[model samples]
Target: MVDADASPPQAGEPISEQEALRRLRQSEDSSQQYYGAWWLGRMRSQHPEAVPLLQQALRQRRPRDSGDGVEENAVARNAARALGKLAPAAQTAIPDLLDTLQDADDGLREAAARALGQLAASEAIEALCEKLASGPAGAGAQQANSPRLVEPCEALLEALGDIGVNEPRVLAVVKPFLEHERPLIRSAAARTLLQLSGEARWGELLVDLLDHPQLQVRRAALMDLGAAGWRPGFQAIAATLAENSLKLMALRGLVEQGNGDPGDEALLACMDALL
Candidate 1:
């Protein structure tokens, strides 16, 4: 009974799965289509058709003005993100998502990398490595470009970590990133290195990053430690100067990784005073 032409609800307004799919597949308006895809993924749509429809949207990488040089395909990027969220269900979309890693669009590439990571598409290890090195010229390229020291896709580091590719070559490529100009990238390298190698040095570096001057950097380090579930950084994460909610999220992430429990001193201290 709902009219497709109805003015869309507020950006974050809740809508049924069917309505979301309707907007994504049937709407003529680009914003509607984008929002619809976003809603499906954000709501974690359980529709049997969600995967196929999102796969279809994934190929419509039509270029749109990004104000920056990067031509973005917002719809396709959103689809990629949604597919990642629907992983195991979207497992069949792995090849399609893998193809997107070579995309010219940085945003799409980043989204695809994140999706592949969540999927843990081990087959994607080499392709991800190739793209990761594209930022410069493999190891040398990282800081080679002035003003942009890290790989263009910072998420690539996390995706690699998430995928847990621990080959020596992979370690060699990721290690160089630790010295990149950006502290966030450094921390991501730290996380990847830590996960793959289980090295105490990398975890120690992450703990140091918790003290980074930038708020976002500190936040990134917080989550990275949580993702790493690096037990050594537990107290530092609790003590780091980030928002209380962010700190709690990191602690909970660590706990979920089996690093500790709510009764643990760090989580206990953080919960009592959410700074």
Candidate 2:
């Protein structure tokens, strides 16, 4: 069990906001871990200085030594989680949050990426799309190469979908995932694309997914289309709702999207049949 009152800062020597901020800026992972804990503790305080310190900590870049030299920093991850707890008023953190997607440390990169999604900032759409287009490494050469980076990239893609911002660049970034070797990556990309694109594009893209050998991939694509709320996607959902194998998933998407009104009676009927 953790002691809540253990190690409370001594009076007068209580950790200064500047020291916390400086420690957060350290590029060393060890320093980040130390300061990250300090920042988390500070967040619970009602001190007038707390908010700005938290905001700065969130903006601080993560240590660079971890694998996937871009966006994988532990410091960045802790900062993002902290910022999410301070959200709404933490809107000012959005730009920094978006910038974090480009971090060299995959952990930090993904953390920032995920935090932005939680914030759901419309302003981040363009930048997210831009990052997706260039890939997580940004426009420069990538130093770290590892399979671990894919997970963060996948998480970033999912966040983009949840945020629901549409941009042609984002579509282009998502389009290639339909054929990715990793089913999870394919599923995330397909879902994000379905949310950001219209029916025509979704229908065309989903057709490709329907033929995919992986059952999970096919189901994910169908589910994405059904819940996408575009006319073309609705039509695709209607057509697939009769297939015994795909029907349940298609209907599930519709119900989840709250498209069960009188206007969607046909969809609801189809969903009932599937269930």
Candidate 3:
């Protein structure tokens, strides 16, 4: 008799590892619903039985309904995340993950996108770019029916920065967000541009953000510009110092980027007063 709670056998039994793998492959459940997929992914080394099962699970369609409701979807997401741990070796899973990017469920889509980035799958760059181009703005004011979508998009954007893929596409996708009505989106966009600024395309864009009406936006842009070695951004930083609350950040930006000359001394005095 099979023990209900016994960990699925690690070796031969009535169900041959190969046959069990085939069953998992043929299962109708979406890749996202199978908890066993993640387990198999992690055990690929200790248990040779794991690899084929994970690959099969990755090929399965997303679940229409997870038994546990919210937690059900976590199964698929964990599977992708596990595959990410398998990374370059898990390259075969990239296409399936990319397909998940099209899922209507924002969280699932975001998870899959982030996993692709983790895998550093260059093939995903164009699809990620397209998603960013047409996706809803991350700003709080955009009125999304699903509030959770924003973080996933933000995560996908950040992952692009980490993988160093799609420089032009990333800039193009993020440019529109710089004008977003929500400060959160604006901040996220500014930060991403800062991370990718070594390419120089973001320099002009960061400088422009100095003029944003929100003080927070201006502050974030200042920090990014200063870090990127954009000396020209100092003038805007100096102007911001007139606001006592903003003086410290302005002073920091200056000190970090300035040439340490007479202009910097004057700015230091102004910052002292606000301190």
**Clashing pairs for predicted structure model 1, backbone only:** 137-141
- lDDT tens digits by residue: candidate 2, 99-147: 7766666666666666677677777667666666654344222336654
lDDT of each: 0.75, 0.58, 0.57
Q: How close is candidate 1 to the true structure, as a TM-score?
A: 0.85
Q: Count the backbone clashes (under 3 Å) in each candidate.
A: 1, 14, 1
What is the TM-score of each predicted model, taking all chains together? 0.85, 0.54, 0.52
The candidate that wins on lDDT is 1
Per-residue lDDT of model 1, residues 132-211, tens digit only? 66443453254443544333446777788889979987887787778776687788889889888888899899888888
Model 2 weakest lDDT span, ten residues long: 1-10
Better of 1 and 3 by lDDT: 1
lDDT of 3 by residue, 1-275 (tens): 00112243243334444544554455555432353554444454334445445655544435556465544454556566656666656777788788878875566676676677668787887877776776444322333564454445555665565456546767888767666655545545665675565544565666666678776667666655554444445555556623554546645655665453437666667567667
Sort by TM-score, best first: what order?
Answer: 1, 2, 3
> What is candidate 2's CA lDDT for residue 149?
46
Task: Indicate the TM-score of model 3.
Answer: 0.52
Global fold similarity of model 2 (TM-score): 0.54
lDDT of model 1 at residue 127? Answer: 82
